[model samples]
Target chain A: MEITAIITALCLVLGSLLGITGGIGVYRLPDFFTRLHACGITDSACAFLILSGLMFQTGTSLETVKLLFILIFLLITSPTSTHALAKAALNSGETPLMEQQQTQQKREER
Target chain B: MLEAIYGASCLAILAVMGLALLRAVLGPSAFDRLMAVNMFGTKTVLLISVFGFLTGRPDFLDIALIYALVNFLGTIAVLRFFEGRKTPACYDEPAEEQKE
Candidate 1:
């Protein structure tokens, strides 16, 4: 019981910290792609951590089963949506900042 | 002790949600807002689950699942809406040519 508690605490705190950091990144990042990466990291890592912690707290039960389902669904959907969003942006001709910077650098070199 | 942890986690989630809200409001483009909203939805799932545990009712997990499904579908639908507008020429041109 004690060990589980300790682990749960660790997971919750670390996960939420990652989440907050991701939120800040989303707010501060200069472009859509960078912000998407930040959001992806938080969506996967933080969700895994928090859900796992909750799983530990719940022990063997139907709730734990539900948590696991949520985790799996999140893992699958978050990345797919991120990809779709990026693709849509690309289709719309939104050049990423990094690509623009590289082109500018090459022009300067020339 | 567990209660305190859950409480702190809830507070942290709330702060993160606030940041997401800021992004949603200040996003320069529709895609940016969409991404922010998607992220916000993910955070909401976590918040709801944490709250459920805090309140000693794990049934909220089901609601989180429902939210998760809706968020995914919502993003897809909105993105489709955006895409449809982008290339309406191809979608509408053939019909117009036939009409003429």
Candidate 2:
């Protein structure tokens, strides 16, 4: 019983932390690619952790199946969407600072 | 114990949703807003699943799945629209700057 309570508290604390960290990442990250690092972690990993705790409390049911699908969808789409966003950003000339510097240098040489 | 655990997840999920909403409000760029909207949709799926589990409703998962697909499609469409244009398309800015 005590173990269950401890686990519950842990999930609560950890989920909040993940949520807050992701928010900060969204706000603090300078670019779209960097933002993906934050949002992707929140979607792929943090959601899984939170969902697992919820699953434990849910007992065995079809709800589990749904959660499974949610996980699967998240795993597939989170990265795919991030990749799409990243590719579009790159195609539009959004590069990391170092790469931007390299491009600038190459431009000066021409 | 079950209620408490599921409740916590719901609350945390809401917080994440709120964060996404904030991004939607203060996106600084069309892409950031789009990311924020996508984040909101994914968070919504989790929210529905947790709520269904809390209430012992199996049918909700189907709705959640549909929601996930719609969210994915919506995001892809928005991204493609922006991609088709030479700019971020929504913000009318050059270079698609986000944050400082």
Candidate 3:
């Protein structure tokens, strides 16, 4: 029980740190695509860490099963939604910052 | 000790949520707003689960699960809504439009 508590605490702290980092990245990143990358990747990792920590606290029980389910669902959907958002943004003529810079460089070379 | 850890984690999660909300409000483009909303939803799930454990009512995990489902669907649906439009307004650059 002592070991489990330590592990749970470690996971929770690490997850919270990651979550805070991701949130800042999303806010401070320069481009939509970059922000999407930060949001999509960290969202899953943070949730996984936090949920698994909670699972550790619960040990083997129905709550653990539910946490597992939530984890799986988030893992699947977070990326999917991010992909859909990226595709939608691209389809709607939203250009990435890098692409815009590249085009400007090309125009300058011309 | 565990309770104190839970409380600290909760405060951190709330801080993250506030950052996400700031992004959502200050996002220069529609996509940024959408991304912020997605992040916010993800944090909400973590918050719900941690708070559930903190309070000794693990049953709130059910609400977290359902929230995760709805958030995904809502994000996708909103993305689809934006897909049909030609170009969403970008607040950062008003003089340029995507021609294409």
Candidate 4:
């Protein structure tokens, strides 16, 4: 009984740290691509860590099973959503920051 | 033990939620707002699950599941709305319709 409690405590701490770090990534990245990368990391690694910890805390119950299911669902969908966003940005003509600089350089050359 | 975990995680989620809200409010473009809203929805799911865990109830997970469904739908709806209506196949069939 005591060991399970200890484990749950550890999981909670680790999960909280990851979540916090994810939030930091969201704030610190500069451009859209960088921000997307940060969000991907948050959704993938941090989310898995937190969800796994939650599963451990839940142990072998049906809730734990549901938690695992959510983890898998997140894993598959998160990246898919990221891809959709990037593609949409591209399709809608969102210029890359690097390209914007290049275009300016060409204009200056002219 | 459960109470402590619940309280701490809830605080962390709230902190992140605040950050997301800030982004949503000050986003420079439509995409940024959309991305922020997506993050907020994801956080809400996590928050509901944690709250359910806190109260020793399982139904909140069901709510999370439903939210996930709606989030996907909402994103799709927004995308279609923003993309505007496609020109449709019949629009290009003016030559065929001319005979009718």
Candidate 5:
């Protein structure tokens, strides 16, 4: 039990660090698409770590089952939303920084 | 020991939440704002779950689960709404406006 508690604490701390990193990336990254990558880090990995940590604390119980459900739901939905957001951004003509640079280079060559 | 850890983690998550909010406020385009909002919602879900555990009420996991569902749907719905717009009004205006 003591070991499990220690592991749970570790997971929570690690997840917190990852989440903070993602948040900072979102805040400081140069472009919208780059920020999307940062958001994906928190949406997938950080959520997984934190929820799994909570599951470890719960052990075999209804609460564990609920946490598992939340974990799975987040895993599935987060990527979908990220994808949808990216697609919508593209459809709305938001060009990424890299692509803009490439086009500028092509025009200069021309 | 576990409780103290949980409390500390909760505070860290809250700080992250504030960072995400700052991004949303300072975001240059609509998509940037939307992405920040989505990230904010994700952190909110984590915050609720951790707080629930800190208070010894695991039942609050259900609320967290429901919140995850709503956040997903809300993001997608907003994306679809933006997709329907003919002109990219939100993106082009802000970048140019900020330049001046």
Candidate 6:
């Protein structure tokens, strides 16, 4: 029981650390696409860590099953949302920062 | 030990939420704000789940799940709204219209 508790604690800490880092990335990243990468970290790594920690605390139960379901649902939706956002941005003429830099470099070369 | 862990994690999550909120408010572009809002929603889901465990109320997990569902739907709807408003046909329109 104590071992389980320790593991849960570790998971929570690690998850929160990832979340904080992701948040900083969101705040400080240079471009929209880069910030999206930060959100992906939180959406995937942070969420999985936190949910698994909660599952450890709950043990084998219906709640655990539900938590697992949520994790799966989140894993599926987070990326889908990111993709949708990126597609929407691209469709609407939001050129990626990297691509812009490359085009500028090519023009300068000419 | 568990209580301490829960409390610390909650505080960390709150800090993250604050940063996300800052991004939402200060984001330079529509999509940036949109991404910030999405990130905020994700953190809120985490916060709710952690609170559930902290308070010994597993029922909050149900709430967290609902938030997750709502967040995803909300993101998709918002993005779709943007896409519809700025369809590729309008690509030749004024830059002013695209900023929205």
* lDDT score of residue A19 within candidate 3: 89
- Evaluate model 2: give its TM-score: 0.79
The CA-based lDDT of model 4 is what?
A: 0.70
- Structure candidate 4, residue pairs in collision: none
Better of 3 and 6 by TM-score: 3
Tens digit of lDDT per residue, candidate 6, span B1-100? Answer: 8988988889999998999899888757778878888888888888988898889988878887887777888887777677667554343334656688
Q: iRMS for all predictions?
A: 2.5, 2.4, 1.0, 4.4, 1.1, 2.4
Better of 3 and 4 by lDDT: 3
* Model 2: lDDT to the true structure: 0.73
Clashing pairs in 1: none
Docking class of 1: acceptable
Better of 2 and 4 by lDDT: 2
Best by DockQ: 5
Name the weakest run of 10 consecutive residues (lDDT summed) in model 6 chain B: B87-96
Q: What TM-score would candidate 3 get against the native?
A: 0.92
lDDT of 5 by residue, A21-71 (tens): 888888888999999988886768999999999888887999998889889
lDDT of 6 at B9: 88
Candidate 5 C-alpha lDDT tens digits along B1-100: 9999899889988888888889878767888888888888888889999999999988888789898888877787777677668765555466578788
Q: What is the TM-score of chain B alone in each candidate?
A: 0.81, 0.84, 0.86, 0.78, 0.85, 0.80
| Better-scoring candidate (TM-score), 2 or 6 | 6
DockQ of each: 0.48, 0.48, 0.78, 0.19, 0.80, 0.59
Go through the candidates in order and give the C-alpha RMSD of each one to the true structure. Answer: 6.5, 4.2, 3.2, 8.5, 2.0, 3.3
TM-score of each: 0.90, 0.79, 0.92, 0.80, 0.92, 0.90
**RMSD (Cα, Å) of candidate 1?**
6.5
Model 2 chain B lDDT-worst window of ten? B91-100
TM-score of chain A, all candidates: 0.94, 0.78, 0.95, 0.76, 0.93, 0.91
